[model samples]
Target: MKRRRHQKTRGDMMKKTLLAATFAVWIFNVHAQGSMTIYGSIDSGVTHISNVAGTKLTRVDSGNRQPDRIGIRGSEDLGGGVKTVFQLENGYVTDTGAQLNPAKLFNRGAYVGIGNNFGTLTFGRQNNFMFDMVGKYSNGFLLGSFYAFHPGNIDDLTNAGAYDNAVKLVSAPISGVTLGAMYALGEQSGDSARNRAFSLGANYAAGPFKIAAALSDSNNRSLTLGQTTGIRTLLGRTLISGSAQAPVYSALATDKVRSVAVSGSYAMGPALLHALHVQTDISVAAATATMKSSELGVNYRITPANSLNLGVAHTSLNDMSWDQLTLNNVYSLSKRTAVYAQALHQRASGTGTVAAVNSFGYATGQRQSAIRIGVHHLF
Candidate 1:
């Protein structure tokens, strides 16, 4: 009888322990639940340029209206109203089916952060404040025409600049006002200021009027294609021929860059009017070159699914200047699909200057024009 009683007690203890273990697992599941989502966008166009190295060409291009990209984003509930989030995005060329940046798997974005009521703070490769403010408000994106941006996207207000090894903070909207800041470390050995970058931005939106402003400063940055792509041209050693495309990329290791951008928009019934200005200064070998651009644009809605956009701008680099005009029309097939057409012309004046649109290669002559039709899909 004693032996049977002892066995019964041991069995009851084991059952209680098992039940406690199961209850703990159930509690963990409730507290740490999370959700994940995948998303992407593709844009392709058939385009013709009047000049590139003095040659007229017609070709199918990728990412004319917007870059092709795929991304994954997720958030995990950490309890206590706090959540941790992450995003990974890859940019690619739709026509060639190749990665936009051969060196990176996730060239567009890769970041992780935590959030709460105060706002969100993220770390790793991320957008600069200029992109958060002016890029979002600029007609280039709002009108779905990359050519509407300034030549070479000199100020990087349209996201041509990407800062790596960075930390960013964005505040929650307060009274229709939002503010953001970002800092990127140089990561150079024994020198903290060699290749560092920082930016600040502010935005205000109330009803039909919106305004945004941003400024960025960099120290001893690299020579980059478009200021974002790390591809390096042989500008340092090779003597560029006269017929070669002029230097439009970011500055070299001995150079410093500073950019300021301001943009505003107002809605008037079916039309939205926009104004934008950008100033960029690059210090190279103790010589500073300044470029300034000013633009006016409007988007008119013909119907709920069709719209037209017009943009005109002038950019000056000392005695050299360019004037640009663009027209963009878009028709929506659905919430996630659209077909669009764009036309652009640019005229250059001043000694040794050639015409070049933002996305197109340089023209050998003083004038350049392009026309494109494209389809866009988002998923």
Candidate 2:
């Protein structure tokens, strides 16, 4: 009897051990189902500009092709064809290692939302819908491969084109077409419309052709009295920290801004062609001003690792007009790394427009030129 009892006890212990092991494995599998990922890119280059403030300048610059940034993205499956998602991104300067926007930690993007079979609804600081659609047709996504933009990126299609306290939505592509919209709260104490912002955009892609259209508006953009010398001075500083592009009008206290743009691109074999047009208006307490701009560009892929980009843009506001041309050659050392050389030339005519190339400020004469050699890497 004692021997039989011992055998039965041992067997029971083994069964319990196996059961515990199976339970642990099941727990591990359940935990592994959710995923989070961290991703980003870094870029830097050497640049030389002729006639910035009447002097030649050479320095190290960040993001000649694309802005240097780091971001974290996470997603959790909630079952029933729905998921929860979040993203946080930060922008920095490679040369100085300074935050792109000093006021906010995740200045580039920060959003949380849910996604279902229908679409996505997100809330937080985010890029406008117009910017999202225009990226498809703007050369290399925007600003003519980052060499130059339309006289201060007047259409607000370039970097840092985000809105605060906003809600945005993106619909899944249905038959190669998608739509996006966004509304931002100005958050002024008493007046809801004081600094409100909103945008709408649509995009379509089929075969080798793509096109997009967008419209955006902002009201009562805040401006620092000390930093903004005049309407043009403040407008030129739109990309800098504490400044925004909402389509301001006059040199006096500006109130409202609006913009409309359409862009398209066609890819043919090794060559790609792109075109864009934008019209922006600003309203101030004193008067209203309108600016219109157009751009045409082409990209040729010589090899899987080598490419050439060229672009030309023209912008006009009242009596002021400006023109810019850019050419860049990019050679990829690997899938995530590249070395490039670029040249840019710009001219300003008409009465009020000064020769300004991006953030370089006013050129000495009506014409200015620049050259850059740079490297970029993705992670």
Candidate 3:
């Protein structure tokens, strides 16, 4: 009887220990549950251009829809409503698996931050306040890369094109509103004031109305292309003055650039409307000018997996003007995959000028109209 009692006690102890271990695992899963995820996207398409200067109707592969990318992100719970997070993302070419920009690795985004109930503070290369505020309501976001506004003409102002090495602070949402501010350090060797930029932005969403506003300033940078006049002999005209430079006029003065924008959106059921007004000022060393741009768009959901978009924009330069119209259709194949088609038409008000802005190459002002069909998938 003594032996049997001792064996039973041992069995009971083992069962209790197993139950305790199971409970501990459940507790850990509930409290210490954090995750790291890997994600990526691949976008590619075919494009056709019309009205080339010296080329016939050319059909080529489009590199605009989605430059391929891979990314990894993670978060760790620090208790008391705080968390530490990090992200590393890089862009590449899906057709060749080559780095997008050979000069830099992880060219898209690389940042670390702390997040909590208050807000988030991040440092490293990231999107600026203007991009966050204005880019969200862009027609490019809806019409893909075929739209004239995809690049948005901000490359010459900020480093990494649209993003920069900066520190950003975001405040928590209050009454459906949030605000962000950012500053980029020039970090020059002796005169740390050569290439500095700063921005402030705010976003608010109440009921069915949403609004955003932003302001940005950059010192010692040329933001927009200007016109250059030179005497040339063309068709027996003795001192012909025309736009002699390409997209970026090389001989013009260099100075600071400032930009401000306001945007708003409204959504009801399956239809959404958006509008934006942006102004850019060029303070040249000798002459100053301003550019104004405005966009209006609407999107309608035909079904749970399909959407239709239309947009129009007009931009007035110092000496020239242009208008663009875009039409797009998107069909979702899955939660993270979609196929899209876009058609854009742009009109210029000059004798030999076209409203063309190139994001990946330097062949600006060479295309008149373009159409694209593409697929985008995210994982």
Top candidate, metric TM-score: 1
Which candidate should be chosen as best, given lDDT against the real structure? 1
* Residue-by-residue lDDT tens digits, candidate 1, 249-333: 4444536889998999999999999988889886767577677988888999999999998988898866778998889999999
Give each prediction's root-mean-square deviation over alpha carbons.
9.6, 10.0, 11.0
Residue-pair clashes per prediction, in order, are 0, 0, 0
Better of 1 and 2 by TM-score: 1
lDDT of 2 by residue, 207-277 (tens): 99999999888887643322221124433333233333333433334587788989989999999999988
lDDT, model 3, position 174: 91
TM-score of decoy 3? 0.78
Q: Put the candidates in TM-score order, highest first.
A: 1, 2, 3
Candidate 2, pairs of clashing residues: none
lDDT of 3 at 365: 56
Q: Could you tell me every candidate's TM-score relative to the true structure?
A: 0.85, 0.84, 0.78
On the 0 to 100 scale, the lDDT of residue 310 in model 3 is 89
**lDDT of each candidate versus the true structure:** 0.81, 0.77, 0.68
Worst 10 residues of 2 by lDDT: 222-231
